[model samples]
Target: MHNAEIAMIGLGVMGKSLALNLVDHGFQVAGFDLNSDNVARAQQEAATLAAMPGKGRFLAAANLTELLAQLATPRVIALSVPAGAVVDQVTDELLAAGLQPEDIVIDTGNSLWTDTEVRERRYQGKLRFFSTAVSGGEAGARHGPSLMASGDPSAWQYVKPMWHAIAAKVDADGMPVGPFDDGEACAAYLGPAGAGHYVKMVHNGIEYADMQLICEVYHYLSEVLAMPAADIGQVFARWNQGVLNSYLMEISADILQTRDPETDRPFVEVVLDKAGQKGTGLWTAVNSLQEGTPAPTIAQAVFARAMSSQKTQRITAASLFKAQAKSASVPDREAVLDDLHDALYCAKLAVYAQGFDLLKTTSERQGWQLDFAAIAKIWRAGCIIRAIFLQQVTAAYQQNPALENLLFAEHFRTELAERATGWRSAVANAALQGVPMPGIGSALSYFDALRCAVLPANLLQAQRDYFGSHTYSRTDQPEADKFHLTWNATPRVQQAQ
Candidate 1:
């Protein structure tokens, strides 16, 4: 009788890598894919792993029936299929193929959080529907990745050990620990239903903002400062040694220094300027709007990508409207560099603050009760956004779990206070140089708006009340009491009728 502890339904890159990870951790896995070639590749890789000592075997099945037959009773199935309809289709097939009520199905794709909730409801009682948002791309899949799991509490118990075994590890200081290192796994059960996916979505939104902020800095260094690509890469490498150290920063340095094989030019220069995005960032932005939360940096990052996609229009517009010439006098290079560094750090703080605030707001609304500190700790390694910076975030939440915003944290408050001058200087320079810094600029504005006790919304309220009868609340009275007014109250002439 064939016996396997778990079954994997998709054998794409992520699927294959995860299956291999499971086998490496001494868990027997039954794997299946629609494509015969993928199955063969998995089998070959499994053979290689099987040769190694202290590894479990991989069994390739021709069909779902055979796959289920290979698994042990009350089987646990993990799906890495595409986000939308494919997930439902596979779940339906598994039910048809004798998946029992006690069996657990975990969706490990970047599905919309609402969809995850819907699926859990749709498959309730028939089978345990669960989800875990996996991050760190293909390499992390093969080695270790940060996992955010949610759904039925009972299902979590069944999958916890397997997830912890394959998740990346980190030390107390948030430094990534190697496989042999004695460290804690970067995996945790976030909450019920869509909480895990919701956290992952916010992670992606912050990622978008972080990437755009870096690109804006690169643009300033390259276009405004006229620095060479290699020089900028060196600068990025240096920055990666400090607070800005992160997976994206490290990869960006490598990308910059790399040369295209055909043209022998800087790899970045050879690539197209247009950036593509999946739907996660858009979902984050839309959700922020729906929740009445301010996430301008994240929203602007999404818009930046949208603007980049219209490259042809930008090209024509470039010729049509001329920008004012920049001043010929160059500022002190060292001072400017320092300003940019501090500016980036400050903007990054704002981005995280926005992301966390959104998460907190949604968690309360959904009754998820997500542990902010735990979430930050898990993100310390094996995720795209992993950084030492997250250590401070973890500390902030640990000190005060009900923190209104990250910017209000004592540590972050001091950081912003010390860095405000540099942040202002950097934004001013970018504007004067005619370089677009939407991510950083929007972040600065978000910070200022939060700091302000009184804003110009009074006039805005009046305008709204005038046109749409959307009554305005008086500043002197309780906000619950709204009032309206009639402006142009002069008596009408009798002849007008």
Candidate 2:
């Protein structure tokens, strides 16, 4: 039997969208899923799209054996299953099916990067394992998505054509470039082993911060300004016209504009406050802490989600401690709105700074030769966090690849400085109005901490030494030297070395 070009397992939403995208690129695709219904649906969808220009053939496989049989020698299979043990389970099944050593297996899910590393180690010699973190959601999957692929060079070479063909492309202005567009695709070999997943994790972490900041702005507008949802929706629409223009911001405006048919109320008003998470954001936060990377903005965003999940406890607490008066007097509505925009933009700078800083540290530790510029370029279009500002970021890295932080980039640094007053005013007003702005608040704190030349950590160390005997370093002493002082009055006011 003649083999197909590629095969995708697990025909769920993302999987099916990807399969169709592959088909649209003129690659014959074989798709399989445990559920016959999904396979049948995929077949029907593919058949409908067969008339489109560049459309390729689609084959539905009933089982693993059939799926393997349909693929050519040196088969390239994509696994879009859930993360965790299930990924390993599928890999073992493929290995057991007598697949050749050179065959390629690509995992396209939000699995932890560490797990990807382990999987690569375990699958060594048995088969070539690679991972690609896809962003842009279902629509992205079907059209174009930002792809971050990493693994063996040989395996990447085998799949690079498809990756490039299906990924989003952007022109010089960061506008979406079509399949026929004259621009580079938003896909690249990130690094070795788990670098792709790691970069993707960083993307999601920044997304959490971006989303939380927007929510804070919405909360302040709703509760403090008492603005109608439609009016607030208008504000988001305007924000999307400026540097804040992004996929997430665009959706936020849409969500606010949407009305509920049941009560004719704004859909957002009827939606529950409780938020759900799938662990990627938490993983980013935890990894940042483990690496001793200062990522308060991302960490605070994760904490905000955790705080949101306590809907029941919050309801009870609200009744016990009646709402307080506004934290501060509300300024003129127009003035406040302008300040809020600058505040949000400034906070966003901090979020990306922290996320990229984390990525830099991880890349160094893992020996991954990451291209920060390429990463930014990919995120310029297809990702959830794609923003016009990303174009500037890409430029910043291109100008200086060893950029320490986004805040240090001349463009962002100067902009943040110019926006400082408004940022401060927004955060202070939020506090005065009794609105929680953990994400923005943490960002401001991180910004301040970064600029501080000397912190009070010296005193903190002294206190720690006084109580727990933790050694303290003196300003006059080298970093390797440690000193301890006895706070209690005993004899020579004891000093220890």
Best by TM-score: 1
**1-497 in candidate 1: lDDT tens per residue?**
46899889899999999999999989999999999998899999999999989899999998999999998877999998999999999999999999988999999999999999999999998999999999989988888899999999999998999999999999867899885477899999999999999999999999999999999999999987898888889999999999899998899888889999999999999899999999899999999999999999999999999999999999998998796547858878888889999999999999999999999999999999999999999899989989889999999999999999999999999999999899999999999888999999999999999999999998999999889888999879999998887757736568964
Question: Where is model 2 more than 4 Å wrong at Cα?
Answer: 327-330, 489-497
lDDT values, one for every candidate: 0.93, 0.91
TM per candidate comes to 0.97, 0.97
Q: What tens-digit string does per-residue lDDT give for candidate 2 at 239-291?
A: 99998999988999999999999999999999999888888899989999999
Residue pairs in candidate 1 whose N, alpha carbon or C atoms collide under 3 angstroms: none
Q: What is the number of backbone collisions in each predicted candidate, taken in the order shown?
A: 0, 3
Worst 10 residues of 1 by lDDT: 488-497
Candidate 1's TM-score: 0.97
